[model samples]
Target: MSVLQRVVKPTTHKGKKILLKKEPQLIEGPKKTIFFKGRKTSDKIRHVLKDMYDLKKPDGVMLTKRNDITIFEDVTPVENFCRKHESSLFVMGSHSKKRPNNIVIGRTFNYALLDMIELNVEAYEGLKAFESSKILLGVKPCLVFNGPLWEESDELKHLKSIFIDFFHRESVNAVRLQGIEHSISFNAMPDGRICLRSYKIALKKSGCRIPRVELEEIGPRIDFTLRRTKLPTPELMKDACTKPKELRVTKKKNISTDNLGSTHGRIHMGKQNINSIQTRKMKGLKKTAQERKIERTAKRKALTESNELIKKKKVHDD
Candidate 1:
């Protein structure tokens, strides 16, 4: 008997191509931040609301359609719930006939409001309502502290850490504001208030009076809010880390005995300060009290002996 060989057809009898569907990649960090929409607001206004945190939809709308950014009939219950969960931050949207495009972003802990910022929607063109489900991408916001609070106290530093923790959800270095591309300046006021101003960083032609370098103010001022609130706990702030490690103030190493230039005999007592008026060296270099007293006594005795010699010479001449 001859061996039989079978040939297989690659295509289906219906003439359809076999294809594999692409799997959607899940977004990261929505758990830390949320967008809460109020029930009374119009759907158009509510859905069109956008923040740096929200992702853009393919249909030209900003996506707030996630479980993290849910719609609520009342603000009180949602806020209370967020506090109970010890959430760091949540955004609340409210619009009315009298007030248009009102958004209140707040920081929360243990069901209490720490800081609340109210912003009204300005003119935003080309934004529509669409179904969106994407994560925040390509955001590097600069934080500028332009007032005394930048250095006067640790309060602003603590507050800044909380903001970093809330914004930096994706990676360890994601939320750092290094270059001027996109930025949020946390300008503090002397009156115990923080004026947060957001801007879109861009390069532009310099004026004749100024340098030829590119400018930083790109689009219209993004948003500004002023508020005062108690800082959140450390558990709620992970990214609010200390300042970029102060270049580690490299200490001068001890000179080794092998080096001839090194003198190890003199012990370093402490810092030195001089008193010019007293004609005295610093404590570390000062002469002993007994030595100073002896010098003074010697000078006085020499003057007395000179006077006595002059008197004896005059008596001999008489």
Candidate 2:
């Protein structure tokens, strides 16, 4: 006879417990990104990465040392780095004769690479090129995607989502009018290149209820041509997109909104006896025993009089 041995994992170590145990948070922290360069990089790629890092601000990690890793071939190093830093997003800059001025943007789920898109930086500009007041660090910028191609293909849709996620700093319930400081817009042209434009928002007095809005172009204008993409599997995509129960908006039954912004609801109820229902006890609404008796007596007298009239009418007819 042989006895089977079961291996049990240990949880007594302090460091292990601290590393493994994740406390549930009511509002999770903003997603952090890892910005790094590949073995070979160009001036344009470095500037792009630096500018993007500046945009990401306090929630981003910038690694100055070059890492020898290919994004499409082996993502193991990237995954390890992400796991170590607890980051969910990454942008890698690389340059080579084969693929010059290449930039890759990707996001992770469970510290694993979920999806990534590679783009060739066809044209580039930096912030120093424009003479305008830069947006404050940590201020969220409004993102705009102006192109029908964004909706035409799954790849374009994924790219749009990636861009939104990358630039979007934090989740906010409401934004004040004064908080609108900057905006980033992406325009996909028919030539299969995307134009990324940054602008500073200016609000002036309109002499009315609303303020007049104007956009001034800031620098760091980039034109990208999409090259390679690694999309997530359907199951992985679904799992990544799934929201927690607390975050989901539970639909209220029989509740609807009208065109005028009025909320309406339909209440279903069983048959109700109004007479048996208890109402407020008040002297004006209540009746004494004598009053109830008098009412009953009047009702009986009226019924008897009606019967007598009917009998007299029958006799007259006869």
Provide C-alpha RMSD values for all models, in order: 18.4, 5.3
Candidates' C-alpha lDDT: 0.49, 0.90
Q: Provide the TM-score for each candidate, comma-separated.
A: 0.38, 0.82
Which candidate wins on lDDT? Answer: 2
Residue lDDT tens for model 1, 43-75: 444543553334212111232443232322234
Give the poorly placed runs of model 1, Cα more than 4 Å off: 1-31, 42-48, 55-76, 79-86, 110-112, 122-136, 145-180, 185-213, 216-318
Which regions of candidate 2 fall more than 4 Å away from where they truly are? 1-26, 256-263, 270-318
lDDT, candidate 1, equals 0.49
